[model samples]
Target: MKRSHIPPLLDRKWLAPLLITSSLSLLLFLSFSLINAKFPPPASGFSGGGSSSELPRLPRLAYLITGTKDDGARVKRLLQAVYHPRNYYLIHLDLEAPEGERLELARYVKSEGVVREFGNVMVIGDADLVTAQGPTMIASTLHAIAVLLKRAKDWDWFINLSASDYPLVPQDDLLHIFSYLPRDLNFLEHSGDLGYKEVERARPIIIDPGLYHLKKSGVFYAKERRSLPASFKLFMGSAWVVLTKPFLEFCVWGWDNLPRTLLMYYTNFLSSPEGYFHTVVCNHKDYQNTTINHDLRYSRWDNPPKQHPITLTMEHLDDMVRSGAPFARKFEKDDPVLNRIDKELLMRLDGRFTPGAWCMGSSRAGKDPCLVSGSPIVVKPTLSSRRLEKLIANLLDPETFRGKQCK
Candidate 1:
């Protein structure tokens, strides 16, 4: 059959347009496919057939619980008190702690059935030397943050605690209450007014030997003082902090030079942990407004406050509960008050996890219900959640929330 032949110019023009159209179509299809692959259609429900909009996803907390010599037992107890199937825990015992203690803690964490199953808990094998009121403490915290960012991909917040600290509320209660919060808010006690710290902390140049030497040693003053930094103002507050993951990523990766600049400036500052994060968070424009001016910890300091808070005891239990703080500090190892807290506040027994909705097993014969685990997303908050909610409401009040930020 003789087919009609078009002119060469007409054929070229038609073939070019056809090729161009095919390429454009392919490029668009590939782009749309990639977009869909990255972000799939929202699910109708998480489990049963229901609207997913009704269910709020709980936020995950990444905790860096640190301790020093003879703190292994306290660390273990604190881990048990705060342990949850959904949250991630990184336990670090400082260089002052014996190798045996670190190994013991690692063994204990590996041995736990629930912890082993969830694989959310980690122990730092190579520990840092954290000097009291020194830059090494800040360094250790930054190290932990870096490790957490590298290891976990979904945590919403970073909470730094110590072995001396104990939780007053269960993880489920905390997760339930925090799920309602704006993810960008950062809870930290910060103040730009550095009265005594200007003299005792800011001006003084102390060298933390822990940054160099492997052995633990006291930080020594340089004798010469440096003037206050004009580039950025100094802020100081409690060492305990609960910070958003985005803010921490900024601090760790430091797309801008502000974080690294402040970090270097704070290297010689006394009690850098108290001021480093405060200063960093308050000075940066992007994060300054996110500050919530609270540490979320309860501690009773002596009149004119000492280097550390007074050891919490039975006498302070009522006050602690009234404070509505999630955690409290400076508790003596194996204190009787802790036992009372376990029995009453946490509803936990000896050598058992604090029970929550995720716990599925029966409590028959005083069995640990958490021994059998269920879906961690299921949260059943208690009366304690109400208390925490009230506290958060007060903190987020329009009059107080913005007024106290970065001030």
Candidate 2:
């Protein structure tokens, strides 16, 4: 009586409806269970989506693209040219810029859907003061590196650049080549002599007033000059570099005193960007073998030499492409040669970012194809990247690499 008219659910043999209901219920239960199994976006960036989800993944780069007052636009352009979802970036606008420009730069970077989703792009909330030819130039760069280290440890290398600098290759071109290189390798151009620069840059004991006072100002030379460093030999070269993350960590945290000592030496040294990294790499035994000796950039110094590099124009286009450099610098804004580079070399058109294999959008009528993004990890190396590869291969030759160290 207690079981009156109870449906014999398990007893029904060929009961399609009953079996269907049971199977459907089971399926629903399993479906709901599967929904609960998802982990949050991931504590670490690695995932299981596909090739993208598998493995530890190659690595990321932390970039410090710094500039002064009116350079926000150039900084933005540089960010676009070098943007890769896999990389981390920190754009810093120095105290020289109006607060409004810095705010706009931050807003633009954060607002870009790609950047916001990746969560790898950062703009310095607090800006620093850097005076002309002052140690503050080096300080500003260090500050950005510290911020990057604190923000993300996923990076492999640290590249320092200014807005005046523009990429000659896509980020993928650089990253693909870099992925194969030893993690300890640092791309820096150095010279042991320092040339006539010895008297002007090395011996001067200049104080960067901007180091203390908030307002931007030029370096103020003290009455006295300092002698050449005895503890470490001074090696000077190009200011821009692609530095290994380990070296940067060593430089910034500086567990050893070599970096700290060099910091003091360059405190009064002119053009510290050129000397700081050069000295750090050559003096550090652990990293001395990692130097590439070439800056990976195409720069044309004036025939007679000037305070700045010669501005590249159409005349330099063929030379720039053939140089096998990943970047070139000091172009006049919106120069025609840049457009030519976009068309002939980069396959990019207009002022938009140089589209790479990662760009999947349409390119009809002078549009930005990178607006539509695709696989962030896919790298389609160009003849240009291959050319660069050859150059790098030659530079890393046993005969070449060892012989060129700190020479």
For each of the candidates, the C-alpha root-mean-square deviation to the true structure, in angstroms, is: 15.3, 18.0
Backbone clashes counted, model 2: 1
Per-residue C-alpha lDDT of model 2 across residues 59-147, encoded as one tens digit per residue: 57778888888988878877877777767777878888988888888788657765665666777756788876888888778877776
Would you give me the overall lDDT of model 2? 0.71
Q: Pick the candidate with the highest TM-score.
A: 1
Consecutive 10-residue window with the lowest summed lDDT within model 1: 10-19
- Among all windows of ten consecutive residues in candidate 2, which has the lowest summed lDDT? 15-24
Which residue segments of model 1 deviate by more than 4 Å? 1-51
Q: Please give the TM-score that candidate 2 achieves against the real structure.
A: 0.83
Q: How many residue pairs clash in each candidate?
A: 0, 1
The C-alpha lDDT values of all candidates are: 0.79, 0.71
Model 1 lDDT tens row, 1-407: 11112110110111100101111111111011111112112232132112367545688899999999999988988999998888888888888999899889888887887787787888888777889988889888888888777677789999999999999998877887776666777888889898777888889999988878998888899969999888888899999999988778778766677787888888888999989889988887777877888899999888867789999999999999988889899798899999999988899998889998878899999788998987777666767766677677778766766789887
